[model samples]
Target: MKKKVSLGFKLPAGMKPPEAFELVSSEGADDPAAYLAHLEDSQVEGIVTGMGRRFDVSLISKLPARIKIIATASVGFDHIDVKAAAARGIAVTNTPDVLTDATADMTMLLILNVSRRMREYLELMKEGWGKSLGFEGMLGFDPAGKYLGIVGMGRIGQAVAARARAFGINIAYHNRHRLPPEKEGDAHYFSSLEEMLPHCKILSLNAPATAETKELLNKRTIALLPKGAIVVNVARGDLINEEDLIEALANGHLGGAGLDVFKNEPHFNRRLAEFPNVFLTPHAASATVETRTGIAKRAFENVARVLSGEAPRDLVQAP
Candidate 1:
């Protein structure tokens, strides 16, 4: 008989489970608490989830012992407490690489939106573009010939560099270790992010959120950038201190910002919406049809593999 599995949320179209498994739906309630309540007293061997839920130690301890794997449909596993999952002998898997290009593309979109003041221009158009508009009225800075500093040199960071190069932007990055000359190309590397910040006219945060990275871009770090610098974050929302970012943006210390993620998501700071210099998007960096479908497929494949006495291809280690 095939193993029983429950989906915390509905799968994308055409990404059905294999015949070897009996699939049950939790409808759209993918949150940890709701999903657990839905599966109460059930004997399912696997559960599929996404980044929306918080699978902390408390929740992990309460999960049914019959559950063997928790497959998340996103690249980031920070939402899942991997250590707690490992201690319970429950495997956790994430969908990486599939969303790399999609996220990188969104990063570029943020850069352009903030630098060119697209949000303000769009609002102006809605208000009739004004009859007496002058060329200098809505002038914005061009990214060409500017230095772009990347905080993380991972696959997505490298992909952002490739896209930025086409716009005549010079790339400099700070990572734990320097990349080989072949992989780095002409991009410069800095061992210390603080040392690299002053030279960056446009800064992008692409690092993962960790103990060391949480609130990494606080007031002290923001002071390192040149006055009137632009900041963009496509990574975790916890990376930046929103209070500090808002203060900087208000005082004109930061010329503008583009953010796609937030610490208190779904209910992010309302003050940010009032700032014309800020461009915000609900955490949809990897929202393309193709990428989302790929992630959903990979997540289910992980669940199917683990239930069939096979190791998942994208198993995440405890942090």
Candidate 2:
């Protein structure tokens, strides 16, 4: 007999449901009440969700005993409470590695867009460009020869370094642990973030959202960066303090910023849009067709493995 599964979100285009499982669509799973109701009426042995839903301690505590796993189709698991799920003897897993290149590509896109002021240029084109500009009218920096400081030199960070190197940018990074020489390449490593900031003409955040990383770039830390430095983030939004970043941008401490994620997401701060130097996307760093499909496949594989009494390769922790 096929194991029952609850699908919290629609699959990506051209994707097929996994075999050996009876899938139930749990529409509007973003709503806790609706999701709980769906669970109450179904014997869902596993659940597959995206970051849109939160599986916090409160919700995990109330999950039906039949839930064997919670698999998220995104690399980051900040939305789910892993410890809470583990305590309940439920396996928690996230799709990583597959989205690394896509996310890193998005980071490079942000860096190029912000440094070249593409946001303002695009706006100008939309408004019907009639006026000619002086040579320095809308000057933007070139990435070449500039130092790029990357926080969290993980898979995505290393990928960003490879891409940035192709653009002739110097790479510097800080991480919990230094990468081996082969993976480290020519990128400079910094043991301290504060020491690394002064050299970074461009800064990219690629770290995860954890307690220690929350608001990592607040007023005090933002002051450490060189004047006129550009900021690009393809990581979690909470890694930056929007209020502090806005203040710096308003006061001209920062040259510009490019972001693909926000603290509140879809409901990001309206103040950011007002700035000509700020480029924003609605948290779509890993939205590529190939990446999304790979992520979803990994999530489904994790669910399928656990349901078949085999350990999942990407299990967050043993439950």
Q: In candidate 2, list every pair of residues with a backbone clash.
A: none
1-319: candidate 1 lDDT, tens digit per residue:
6777877666666665667688777776556677787767456888787677788999999998888999988878898999999999999999989999999999999999999999998999899875766767878899989999999889999999999999999999999889999989999999988999999989999999989889989899999999989999999999999999999999889999999999987779989989998999999999887888888788878988898889999999996
- Residues 38-75, candidate 2: write the lDDT tens digits: 98788889999988888889999999999999999988
The Cα RMSD in angstroms, rounded to one decimal, for candidate 2 relative to the true structure is 1.3
Residue pairs that clash (backbone atoms under 3 angstroms), model 1:
none
Model 2 worst lDDT window (10 residues): 310-319
TM-score of predicted structure 2: 0.97
Question: What are the lDDT figures for the candidates, one per model?
Answer: 0.89, 0.91
lDDT of 2 at 110: 91
Q: Flag regions of model 1 displaced more than 4 Å.
A: 13-18, 28-34
Worst 10 residues of 1 by lDDT: 9-18
